[model samples]
Target: MAAATFIEYSKGTQFVSTHIYGSWWFCMLWGALAIGTITYIIKMRMHSATLLLLHTSFIVILTGALITHLFAIKGLVHIRKGITTNQYIVNNGKEIKTLPFNIRLNNFNIIYNNGTSAPKDYISYITITDDKQSKDGYISINNIFTYNFVRLYQTSYDDDGNGTYLTINSDPYGIAISYTGYALLFFSLIWLLIDPNGSYRKLLKSPLLKKGMLCIMFLCGFSSVTQAASTLPDISANKFGKLDIMYNNRICPIQTFAIDFTEKLYGSSSYNDYSAEQVLTGFIFWNDEWKNEPIIKIKDNTLRKYFGLPKYISINQLFDKNLGGYILGPAVQEYYQGNHDKLHKAIIEIDDKVQLIMSLRHGEPFKIFPYGKGDNIIWYSPKAQVPKSMDTDKAMFVKNIFTLLNQSAHSGNYNQFNSLIAKIRIYQEQNGGNTLPSVTQVIAELTYNRIPFANILFMINITMGFITLLYSIYRLTSIKNNRHITKIISYTSIIIMLLSFIALTYCEILRWIISKNIPMANGYETMLLLAWFVMLFSLIFYHRFKILITFGFLMSGFFLLVSHIGQMDPQITPIMPVLSSPLLSIHVSIIMMSFALLSLTFICGLTALILYVTHRIKHDEKTIIDNQLSSLYLLSKILLYPAMSALGIGIFVGAIWANISWGQYWSWDPKEVWALITFMFYAIVLHKKSLPVFNSPLYYHIYTTVAFAMILMTYFGVNYFLGGMHSYA
Candidate 1:
């Protein structure tokens, strides 16, 4: 499956799906596994219903997949407005299939975000005619239309909105079986967690495990230094930042926009002493001076050397005065003409940065002045063209508002500038009205931006986490027993972590309120949520497994670090219509929680390995090392039951979501394949009798430590290296 993902990138989904996943050999492999599982269950005389059902569910799911591969008819159909279509193309356009009913596209509509051109949803109204009987229905992203055992999903639409394209699936038996399997899997997992006779429960009841748990319970708890002052006039930039504007398909405070804009251009939200708002104000009011500021970051060494530019280059530096044109103009042209080598890609990237700065200089992103009424309202920048039908006075105000504000700022007339801002706010309220975000939401977002808790908390978390981890290890290893002092230190660390977790939770709530959606839509948001889950789980289980608190701090801190690394956008924007389902929230939350558990297991494995390598214990002290290793292995085993189950459940939940949104349960996308691989790879540790090596503490820790690589590949590697539909996550 892993190899298939990379191969699919080159050969396309159809080729890989046909030759790899859908091949006879793949089906045979699944058949062999199913047969082997049943044989093993019979040989071992396994009678636990939850365990039997859990293993049986995978066989059923595989059978469903095989049936789907053999019998499902998946295709696409494009229907023009007022035209009836019964034929669809399938098998990568090699075969055509006819539906039992004719679908006539009655209308196609693109629903836009309030005060913005960004599409919120695509709806296609259609009438299905079958045997002289007709039914009217609508198909949308997550809302599918079914008729005569056929499903139609909204795929795309014509640019002119006169036609619509939909994905068609006719797989009644396969989907039914697969969904049954999913339901069984879910129920069995829940049952296993609570089952009195389950391995997990049995292990927990063991005296050795209880004694080990009790024995360990006491140990529980910059990019650049550029000092460039803002050149904007000394005015209330904070007030300006508070004003609401249409940005990135949603209405948010300009404070959010300013922070994102500054970070995009300068690689940080602040430049020396000036705030993001101040820096943005400078660019809008003092374009010429700001253009010469060396704020644009060029991280590519080769690209920098090619242009003979510094690490951070000014907008003016990108313009070749000698040639009287943009320096990257010729390179960009070559890039468009199919010269897509590494250098060209880098050139295009730098060109995009330059273009962003140029857009700011032209005031293209300042869409603050709302005009028109109802659903037709549009937020217009000063440079945007105004309709002639608009009220003359309103149109004039929209055109001259920025110029007036600039003049007031240049003249240092604070009163006039403030008044102008107030007038614009009034104008927005009048035009934008209820479509605009509430003042409270605006204030919350502004406060959220100002806190920067993720930035500050990450550093503190890592520092305190390291200290606690080392101290805990020392206490566990050394003969010294300074219980009083260690207890004080542990409590202090716990208090700090509790405070940090509260702060993170508060910020997440504020973000959720501002976006009006769960904060699991993108990589940055999901990473933050994952960090929160780690801390949450740690706090929940730290009493029993005290070292988890230290691991939690380190893991959460590193997750935050990954979120901030590279070019992650921290902006809270609206998610696509397909992602607006409640199932998506549940799916991502479960997955993130599972990841947190898996992360703790990895840390346990690492700690055990460190003990094995760092300390060559004498015969007298061998018992201590063996006991510690045994405890670590037990901790990992306890974590694996839930971690593996959650991962399996999360994957299937995601499949259900995909089925609802895209007319297919599994597309074998790189992320999906890698996730499956991770689940199966880790499943080996659970079968200790079959894989007896895992019975040994040393081998168990080694296998788990290495098994963590699959988790990393599934989460990070799939996003960065193996691009897929789930890359947004």
Candidate 2:
């Protein structure tokens, strides 16, 4: 697999590597090993029939794969609309292979999400014809059609929609056997999960697990909060709200609109000093103090130059004070509240008869007919498509905006503009034929508001957890007895983590309510979920295994801090079409859960390492620290199999989803490669106990800690550096 990955990366595309990997020797070696394992399990572990069946499936899969490699015919076929082809290029264009039947492309069209340009799906209408029979069918990324032991998979397309490309695979015998093996493997996994040997089944019986489950249930019980609507501010009243009208392929709330506009305009959704919500409301409502807030923080010198500013400027200085004139020229007057006595607005000077400057609101004003001269000029739609039928509404909207500007310019009283803005919004809403944005706006406000409840809870957990940890350490080291106080402090920190988890989970729920999509679609949301899962694991296993409460709080706090980064801002944006899969949600959630479990083990491993180092340095006999180290080591060992199992299942499930979405089960995409690496690394960690060198608790802790590097690569490294299909993060 490693060699195949290298070849794919260096050579580009997996065609050559696939042929090399499909070699007979490679297939037979794996098949032999699988067969040997199945035989050993059956003969030695007579009582473990389930285990035997599971091992036997591996041989079945290998045998099927070997057969497929030996006999399968695969190539790419590109058929232009209104054109038919029966031959496909094969072996890196070295030759062409003629199919048994002619393939005709009827039409190829891309499906986009409603109201947004994001592609929802790709489909190719096709017809298959032979001398004796003809069939009409279509193929999509996730949907395939099979005829006579041959399969057609939607693969790629030309820049324009005129041509459709598909992968044609003909494997007469091996696919059925492989599918049978896959079915058995899935059933075996399900059986193992429900059987007594399953870690989850045994853990479910523990009181701590029951308590954890109860807390989750109690936290999620009141779901009605998501249903309430109609409380958010008027959509039309907020210019920023109207600016970003589309989200998730539909018209979103004004709050979402406002944040998206600012996020793109300022290149940041929020700041440490001012939340995205505050900046949005402040800008929309035209609150003097809020507008004066230094929300538009500029770090780039080039941006500073672009804005015609010194090193930095506040939102008020740049926009509210009409300082935008320095950069935007005359059009700045439209956005300005008439704060300055003179306007240095820039003009477009079209034909020297008409001078115009664009407004930053939505870009390109409407061009009104009978173009008037000077400041009295009327602008109609830029696209020259303004409906003549609704002239009254258009006139009213323009009239209200002009009135508001006049009031700001002369009387310096902008309060009446609010009512005018509301009227304008109503007219705009009617024109656009959209539903009320109040529900989505309210949810966005709740989510992006300053120092959100989730953040506050995390802060409390971090502070309290640190204090408790310090106090507990003191009690452990000192001769004096302070057991009662330590116990109180420790439990308090645990309670704080519980509160944090609940708060974060509620935020996720609210997001689901408003966006109507699973919140695990992005890095920020996934990290938040990861933190919640970490807390869940700590709570469930803490009492039984003396899992470190302090570690949970610290790790959760760190995760929240990462989530708080401006780039990772939890802004509700539209998700890609490929992400709109039930399997995607399950894949990401499972991967996150596995990472969370591994993170807990990481904490244990680190604690054990620290104690081991301390004992070695002090040359002391076994004491409290030594006993604690042993407990942490035992806890890590106990968790190893569950974490490994989760990682394995998640990686495989993701492959299944990829097969559905990309038409190839294994793409060797960078993220997929790293995930496979992570799985293999964890597998080694889990089985290392069999080796004498790694049998010691010290070596086990060290290996577990070191193995976490692969997890980091799978999550962060693949996301930020080794970009690929999974680069949505």
Candidate 3:
């Protein structure tokens, strides 16, 4: 199944996915598994009816999915306001699929984020009518409408607000059957967990387990950690560092603003220990590449054929009193001298990465025509190479401000420079007409030192997790009374995990307060929340199952480390329109939490398998290995129940959200299909104990370790490799 999913992902086609599942041999294989399962149940009369239904639910789900593949109708309907459309595009725009009913778009509207044009939601108001009935409704991402067995989902809208595009799917027959299977699967697993015959009920009854659960519950409450308001400083410093300017729709201290600006331009926040503010300051006033080397030395001559005629030009030449008389002409050199207004007028935008550098260079032979008849030619005039979409006023403001900055850097005129920054702040507020605060532009330097605790917390998590794993192994193998020290270290690790959890929760909340919305709207925030869930659940399960502490620490530490990578750097940004649903927060939390639980289970399964293999080879410590294996098997079992259940619920909730937002509950997008596959794979693993042929503990461990690949595909593969409706995730 993992191989098939990867193949489908590589192909980037839904038809390829259907081909894998809809193949005759695939059906036959599933049919055989179903028949064999039924036969075993009938012959053995399994002790648990819930187990029988759980196993049978797979067959039912496959039946529904196959029905969808063969009979479902999926297409796209694009409509403008007051326009009625019965035909929709299908087969990748090759043909038209006509619905039995016609849909009329009454109105299309979008809700924008506060003080910004970024859309928070896209709503399509529509009415559907057939020969027998008529229905009027509205649809948004996560909100859908059904009429005459067909579903409509609002997928996108024209930026001009003149048209709305919706995806329509008619798979009434298969969806009902599939949903029935979904319910049965959900209930059957819940029954297995709580049933008198189940192992979970036995584990829950233990006094030690119950007490441990209480402590875990207490620790989980740290999710609500809060912080006090911060006070801003008003003092003499870098003037540009004090002025606030908005970037990426986030309001922050100028120090933070500089970091984000540099990140966008240089693809990193800092270089050679110089913070973004330092880089920006140097770029504007002294020199951009502030090193011993001559800035902007035209050493790469290419035979010196591009420019009409020029000796080596260095930025140092600008300060040479004779530059205006020595260079190409006075008109160009005068701008580089003291004519701040003239220099500002010559600035123009070229690209986002070189916004500051390109604007500073302006007209002095900086434009390189890299292709065509004038390839590699350097244009001396700003008008010869300026982009049509350049915001001239913004460029001018930046240039004039930087010119004052250069003078201040040269003569130490701090008061004048500071006043100019304050004056510019007022000008930007009154005349800039930007949604974000003008203060965001202040050239304050910032580094990772601000949140040293966050760094320390992550280190504690990883280091403690590693130490606990080592201690856990020592406990497994040692014969001495190390319980006291082990307990101490264990408690200390738990304390650190608690602190880390609180710290992360605080950061997430602070972002929510600043952004005025839930923080799970992006990848970084979602991953952070996942780390919290892993720690919380691991701590919760720790008391009842002490082995989980090691696994939890290792997994949480690893995931948190991944979250800290530069790519996942948690920068506060605007949420996309489709992610504006109220259900988005709940939906993402459930799914991420489910993945965390399953990750711990995967670790337990791997440990069990290793112990079993080691026991077979050594033959010396069979008893100890068996004891460890028993505990691990039980832990994995206990963890899998909730993991599978949560995944199932999350998938269904996502479908409901999809229907509300897109108008269809199921679209068989790569991500959606993989999620279903993951749920079913775990369901089959749950029934492993019921079937004698697969009752061995080895099978249990192997199945779990392998089935985890499905979750990996659903979470990572779908996002990076497969094309899907859930691509926004």
Candidate 4:
């Protein structure tokens, strides 16, 4: 009944369900819905468009996720040097499949500008085919290839032609859900906006609206499905393979690998097909030339000929593991051609592309097999693209050429640093195989879209410190305040508001610059960049409503107070490759702008609290208090609406940017979680008019204080504790 049944993982961790669900998507969707609901219930008021966007996006995103989690196909293909002139190995996690069609690697090339010498970041290229059209794949960073619904990326490189390339794959199901979510969310926005002058009330109360809401609720239910879809699964197979070389007795997973060989035009692709290459016999040559490449007596003469000639498949030439198979692409062609052995070339795929080339050895022939290989499966040395000339016999170092294959690794692959073992194998009579390098070489290069967040503690702290200095000076100068002095003080407050705005702008610009070299590498930097943007824009409106300054002072002061109280993190410097991108500027900048924007509402609520705190002290107090409340009301009017409006705008913009870059409008990253929280914070403040108890200043201020806490969490707290992609800084 099941397409593929997986026995209960880890023996028995009980709970019964036949359909497999992915957590990455299912968990996130449900998480989004639950979080969204909680925010809606608490805030009480919301932008009809945002609610729609959030809901619709969730549905499509989850649907795509279901398709991905439920049924996604994955496999790998391999290419080898003269050995596998035929088919490439196709690797899948559970089973390795040998394809019928023979793929010949034509050539591989790395083209780069002559002017720049910066390790040619994007100059790699490769070509491979199914015996038909000349297909190609190229690699850069972040961008991979699109073949049908599957996108391919070059994951790694190796010298041995053994499988070592790594690739990132996306199941179309996730994208489908993502697209559906976007369609629904986007359409809902249009539906939300068509309301007439009285549309607000009508939209909120309509029966259709209620149904739409119900649909959203049902759509939200899909989160359970989505979470199961999005979760990353850890899989261990019976055989593992590298560079088309399989590890015996382990589950063979189809995988892709890359080769950034010692030379250019050498980047390529290779996969494992679980072939049985067993080493049948080994021979030791006593001649002094043995040092360079010991003589090997293969069991069968016919089998030995298929290996080409002593000149073509020489021992010394073929055995250098360090200078091994990392060579892929056109380099294989160039090497084979130069040596004058134009047989089948090695083919490999890098980036989303592939390359093919023929190769031959220039050194002496070392070992032979009886038409069969021993060590049925073993990691192979990336064969060296043998040169045109072989080292003379005088160069022999008395090294062991033939080795009996074994499980795990060759005699010296793992922790090769053991000198005692090296000494033991060094005995002249014993097979003293060369010391192979560590498996670390087998480790793939760590290149991701971005590391996703970190660093910048220094920047936030420095900015806070700078702003606090200005406030400290203003407070120090206030000795006696008559009405005239109050006017001057008001003007000073205006300056601070404007400066806060300026500071935010400056931070954004600096981040823009910083992100060019950092942050763009991952999702976290993008989020921080957005936060900064939100903070910057919020200031423009505050300048229009000067009353907001009273609250602004408290808000800014609170930030300063918290910084002083909390212990600072050490080394707020940039780290990780993904942290380097301009996207961080956009992501962090906007989010911070929202913080500055929504903060004013929190301040107004604070004023309301104070008003309630001393209500009985009214009458004359009303004059002074009126001064406060009047300022507060003017500020609230100017502040609350715009703050809410700006925050809403910032969030909307954020979602748009996220969709453009990541393809999904909203991910339940910590930043997203906070954005929802921040939106709801103001939503409650705006709708509180419906609640009598909250009408009192004290209650308002108390709620505002709580809201402020949420703001703090939305900005700083999430990063500090609740880790997510945007948690970087």
Candidate 5:
């Protein structure tokens, strides 16, 4: 039973994929999809043994994930502090399904948060069990217990109050996730110098080798493409049990019930007492039938038959649990009233702190009157109760859904709420109704419990890609490119640009199959999406200025790589805190555009350095043949200048975005540092006097390598090691 987590697709189309079987076995789908993906890669007519081998690791990763989960347990073990006797807690660690047995915790410890809200530490001593046989052990974060196939992460606490709170967990899929991670990391390593954009020596003297390399490049791309496959479902979103969410709609017994200020305090703030009116935050459990409505009689009262409300009391008789009596606190005098119509228009004050406002009347939802002004309320409730339906309201349909919800709660099938509205419209139509299931309920389901932290797959793969990119640049400088080298650089950049653009677009669109109005939340996602925009612009601008095209491609690759790596964030996590801002999406999109544009400048700078070192240039030959060719010096002179200009403009626009989002012109964050560094490198490359220690071909390649390294340091290194604003996971 999933607690409360995203049950279906987020609004974005990038992270979640659609499957016909209605199972969230995306990990499983990835395995099967990997097979088809393998076949597709082979069929691409792109055959290079090197490329094939380079990407084979990806297939291995898929194999690894399949093996780890289906055959082994790869989950985390939590450790906390608490116990009468020093021991361990061993659990079968299965979720939804009942775990096989319990592993006791012999001992546990806490690593306190040293600084304000900083990191803490955990250590747990645990013991494993199989029937009567048992063994003792202790585990911590990044520590494992292999015999029972368990990995332990110092996760949470279990306080026994008497200074004892220790707990631990054993995760089955933990190893599988790790294997997938390493597989991705390995793929990036192989891809760095071997893929289309890598720094491999272009042995194009042999046309056969060139063609073979082409095939290899395709294989690499093919491998990357497979990662887009789906995996396993933990009974999350698709199916509905007794009262799956499809049948419940948004109606639940867990209403945030509120009763207005019962009494106001009479004295000063220091010695003030307040009275509160309480209502059921919980749904009517078991036998309780809240038949306050004349038209409805929904009850399963056998649960708490004797539980009944006390006599309905006036404001003076309201209970004051905090103050031990009905006396009001000094600061609460403002709530003294007879009919408290304004109370229904008030925010809840808990322990004298402001909380949610009364957004409805008794048995009815409130009209959203803004802090002081608003005529835009969609609907307002007259009383705190369900509104009477219209003649075509399909009351029976509503009743059925609520019944399902009640039943699901009774049966303890929490995930069934994942599809409580399983047959909303069909029943509605059958019973005479006009409204159908909203798109949110048509196919997708969401519950916060399904995932913990952010979508981590992006965090690892994208980050690893950047590390590989840096290594690739290192490889690039050491290799000598003959005449064919230029051709490969020119051709590969263009082809990769095309591929990147398509892949980026597809990634962006895949976000929302069920449509929960969420964007790609991870930093990796933002980077990729932003890079696509950047490349799209580069492709457009590069076509206008030939030099800029090569420059822009390099820039796009750098930013995209960094973005991929920056997706890793361990400290930060995914929080759906109901971000209610109308301007957020627009502001974010604009910032993304700025990132892409700035990226274009970075590309130009790298191209300028590489061109300067090579000391020779070749046109597409097909385009400028039969004409007096411009000298290499003249071309380099012209290209570097424009490239520099583009870089500057991109940075300036990026500054504008920084100001709007963060309310600052710039922050010395890692990604920002790299952006600026890239800008400076290009600017210097344009000026003769500022050239680095090397001016020859070798030096040029070396500079290019260093420049891109700086890019990596800014992207992945900064994100991973140094940390920065862009270090979002």
Candidate 6:
């Protein structure tokens, strides 16, 4: 599957689906697995209902997939408004399928958010005419319409909104069977956790485990300045930031725009001693002075040299006096023309920043005044073109607010400046009406922006976690331990981590409330959620496995760090229409939590490897080293059960979501294939009897530690290298 992503062998022929997944060998492999599982269960007389059901669920799911591959009819239907259609195109237009009924598109509407042009939903109203009767139905992104075993899902629409494209699927039997398997799998996992005789429970009951747990508890004790100051009044700038504006197709405070803008150009939310608002305000009012401040970050040394610019190039420097044009214009044109090698890609990035600064200078991005009415309302900056429908006086006011505000700031007329800000707010309220966010939501978002909780928490977590890890290691290796000191350090570290967790939780909640959606829509948001999950699971199991506390802090810190990586944008934006489903939230949450648990398992494996190496070097007591290794191995096993189960359930839930939104349960996208691979590889560790190698603690630890690469590949590699349908996640 991984190889299929890179090698486009037999390009555009459905090579992967036909030659790999749908091949006879693939069916034979699944058949062999089913037979092997049943034979093993019978030969061993395995009477555990939870275990039997869990294994059976996988077989049933595969059976359903095979059924779908063999019999499902998937196609696309495009219906123009007021037109009836019963035929659909399939197989990249190589085949046509006729529906038993006709579907007439009554109307197609692109629903926008209350005050913004961002589409909230795409609704296609249609009348289905069958032989017996006719029925009216509506289909949206996640809302599917079903009739006579055929499902219809909204896929795309004509730009003019005269027609819509919908996906059609007639796979009743396969979907039913797959969904049944998903349900069984979910229930069996829940039962396995509570089952008194389950391996997880039995392991907890073992005497050696109890003794090892006590020993673990005992050992727990161990552990930019360069930019010139903006001359703008900080107070007024901040006050201006409170006023609402339309940004990224949503209504938000100007502060949100400023922070995003500043971070994009300067690589931080603030420059020198000025806040983001002050810096941005300065740029709008004092473009000549601000443009030459050399604040824009240019990280590529080669690009900087080619342009003969410093590490931080000013806006003015990007325009060459000798060339009489933008320095990057030629390269940027090449980039647009599809010359996207390493250097051109970097040029495009710098070009984006340059373009953003230019936009800010023209006041194009500062859409602060609401105009028009109802769903047609548009926010206009001082420099934006005014619509003819707008009242002449209102349009003039919208175009001159920034000019007046700039004059007021220059004159240092505090009262006038304050009144201008207030007037803008009032104008927004009058025009934006209920579509605008409530005052509380705006305040919450402002608060979220100011705190920088993720930034602070990552630093605190990494530093404190590393300290605790060192102390824990000391306690582990030391023959004579200071119990009093260890307890104090352990308790202190836990308290700090507890506080950080609470802060992170508050951050996520604030983000959720502000965005009006769950904070798991993109890579940055999911990483933040993953960090939260790691801390949550760590705290839950801290007592039984004290080492988890250290792992939790470290993992959470690393997750936050990843969220801050260059490619991951930390800005909070509205989710796409397809992501509005409640199922998506549940799916992402479960997947991230499972990832957190798997991360902990990796930490356990790493710790065991370290212990083995340390014990060998020191020639430590055989019994003592073995006991430690045994405890670590047990912890990994305990984590594996839920991690593997949750991953499996999460993948299936995503499939169901896909079926709802895209009219197909599985498309064998890169992310889906890699997720399946990760699940299967980890599942091998659970079958200790069949894979005797895993029965050995040393080999088990090594295998698990190495297996973590699959998780990394699934989560990070698929996202960065192998583009897929789920890349938005």
- Candidate 6 structure quality by residue, lDDT tens digits, 264-359: 888888887888998888888778889888778988888877877788878888887799678889998898899988888889888898888788
The true-versus-predicted C-alpha distance at residue 228 of model 5, in Å, is 28
Which of the two candidates, 2 or 3, achieves a greater TM-score against the reference?
Answer: 2
- For model 2, what is the error of residue 591's alpha carbon versus the real structure, in angstroms, after optimal superposition? 1.5
How does candidate 5 score on lDDT?
0.37
The lowest-lDDT stretch of 10 consecutive residues in candidate 4 is 274-283
Predict model 3's lDDT versus the native.
0.62
- In model 1, residue pairs whose N, Cα or C atoms come closer than 3 Å (at least 3 residues apart or on different chains), thus clashing, are none
Q: What is candidate 1's TM-score against the reference?
A: 0.96
Predicted candidate 5 versus true structure: per-residue lDDT over 1-729, tens digit per residue: 010001212222112213321124756566676787678667775365544643564566456445543454223334233322323433234342223545566666654321111223445676666666877776543343444543333444556412323232333453345445444444444454345532232322334333443222221211111222121122421232112111111211111111111112211111111111111112122222211211111122321132232222122222357656633333244444433333322312221311121221132232110111121111212222233542334334443454675576567666674455455424333432112224444323222112211233234323433433333333333344343444454455556556656655644543333223345455655665666665676567443333434434444555555543443321112222212233344444544564454344344344335433333343324222111012212223333333333443444444434423222223344455566566566445433333444334334333444554544454455555554355554
lDDT of every model, 2 decimals: 0.84, 0.60, 0.62, 0.37, 0.37, 0.84
Instruction: List model 3 lDDT by residue over 479-499, tens digit each.
Output: 564545765776776677777
What local lDDT score does residue 253 receive in model 5, on the 0 to 100 scale?
11
Where is model 5 more than 4 Å wrong at Cα?
Answer: 1-500, 509-522, 530-647, 657-674, 689-698
TM, every model: 0.96, 0.75, 0.73, 0.44, 0.31, 0.96
> Please, what are the lDDT tens digits per residue for candidate 2 over residues 1-729?
545555655565555355655566766767777777767665665565555566666677667767766777888898999899999988878899899999889999897544445566789998899999999999986688887877888888898889988988786567667667766666665665567865446545655344453222111111011211111133323442443244434445445644554554355555443444445544433434444444344544553565466542443454344543434445444536554332212221110111211132332332212123332222243234444554665655553564364354244344554555455556444444323345565556445542364556557766755664555444444456544565566566667667777777777777776566888887878888888887788777666543456667767776776666535755565676567889888888888888888877776677677656755676657765555555555566656656666676677678668656654555557777778778767766544423565556677788888888877777776677555667656
Error of 2 at 176 (Å): 3.8
